[model samples]
Target: MLIGEVARRSGVSARMLRHYESLGLVVPSGRTVGGYREYAETDIQRIFHVESLRTLGLSLRQIGQVLDDPGFAPSALIGDLIRETERRLAREQELLKRLRAVDASGPTAWEGVLRITELLRGLGSPSAARRQQAVLAAEADVPAPVLAEAALAEADPHVAGALRWALARAGEDVVAALAPGLESPDADVRRRAVQVLADLPGDEAAEALTSALADLDPQVRAHAAIALGARGSAEAVPVLVAMIIDGVNDVDAAEVLGALASDPGRADAIKRALTAELADPAAPGPARLRLVQALAELPGPIALPMLRALVSDEDRTVARTAAALAGVIETQDGV
Candidate 1:
């Protein structure tokens, strides 16, 4: 077959076939009487081999070595090709994601597009400060969904705070965007989602947070409790009480519980729960101590009786602390 026939049959352009010939990658079996290139069956087979190797991302030079060197082991080359393909795939996926984010933003002008692009770059920057600045500098044109996605993946505390702040201001759009994150199998992502959702206002955000209270991850549940407690939701009472008992962010949990207890009904409930936990003999000594400290935040009517009973207890630290709280309670009560 002639070169033209090979090009037509193999789908390799004539120019590319000529280039391959110039590079000595594929030589025709012979020449016609007119000095035209003539490709035999073996040359066509070699062309297919070159095309197959090219599909694996081999450079022309590498392809030359692969085709010429009998001792060339494809193992190392194949490994490198795999890594290069993976890197290319990653880049393509990232680009696709950015494009999707930009499309979701609905930018009407080049300026909006540029701004969103810059913000996306900043959010992905290596420097936490840049990430923070990106979030702080986010404008109305920046998509809330973009910020919501960034917040879920952010690891730096400051950057995450900034992202949450940005998302919170975006309103319910952000709440909707964050809803999927709550269902993430990753505990950290779920916790981050709850953290952001807690700061968001509206019944939608509240519903999400209320649902998060039942999250399988303890961290997610704790965050939901704190957020709901701060929002004065009585449903948070049990989790807040549990956090106090478990001594995880107990001080902050106690403070939130105290705030929730400002309502007369909640105050009574909080008092009862604390007292119940205190009276459980299976409760460790340290846990009891934490509960005692937590009770000090309650109204004197509820806490004084518990403190008085604890004052003469066998544990001297508990007795001393209880005595001191009782003294303060008595002073406040004008006793």
Candidate 2:
């Protein structure tokens, strides 16, 4: 076949076929009387092969090595191609996300678009200070979704706090954006997400925390319970009691439970829960100690009976700790 027929059948443009010939990638196997390039069947097949490799994201140089070098191994080259394709895909996906965030912001001008883009970059910056700055400048029109995403992924304490603050100020709509992070496989992400939800004021955030109370991660459930208890969600009573028993952030848990117990009904429930845990013979000594200490934070009328009973308990350490706490509770009552 002549080069024209070869180009037509193979879908390779004649100019590209000529370029391939110049690069010695697929030279014509013969020539006509007019001295035009002519291609044999093998030459046309090689053109098809080059096009096939290009679709796999192979560069022209890599294709040349693959087709021309008999000693070339494809395994390493194929791995490199996969990695390059993945990197390109990641970049494209990130760009698409940024564009969507900008569109979600309803930016009306090029400058608004640019500012949103820059703020997103700052939020994702490696520097904690930069991330904090981005969150602080969020009042300048950063979208809530962007702040929510950054807040969920952020590990730095100060930056995470700022991001939560910004998201809360952005609006309650961010609750929807943040709700998914509660189910994240990463426990740290789930914990951070619950913390942000805690700071956000609304029934939406409260509902999210109430749902998170059953999360598989103990830390996540503990954080959720504390947040819920502070908001007067009595559903947290059981988890708060458990936190005291497990000695996980038990202090904060006790404090929040104390606040929740200000209600007469919740106080009665909290008092019973604490005494029930104490009644379990299998409850470990350290747990008993932690429980005794937590009861001190409860109202005097409810805790005094338990403290009085525990002061003469079987365990000496428990007895001493309970005695000391009872004295403190009684002295405070006297005042």
Best by TM-score: 2
Measured against the true structure, the TM-scores of the candidates, in listed sequence, are: 0.84, 0.93
Relative to the true structure, how large is the alpha-carbon lDDT of every model?
0.88, 0.87
Q: What lDDT is obtained when candidate 2 is compared to the true structure?
A: 0.87
lDDT of 1: 0.88
Go through the candidates in order and give the C-alpha RMSD of each one to the true structure. Answer: 3.0, 1.9
Model 1, 32: alpha-carbon shift in Å? 5.2
Instruction: Evaluate residue 85 in candidate 2 and report its C-alpha lDDT on the 0 to 100 scale.
Output: 86
What would the per-residue lDDT of candidate 1 be over residues 80-173, giving only the tens digit for each residue? 8899889999999999989999898898889888888898899899999998998898896567789888999998999999888788677548
Q: Looking at model 2, report the run of 10 residues with the lowest lDDT sum.
A: 134-143
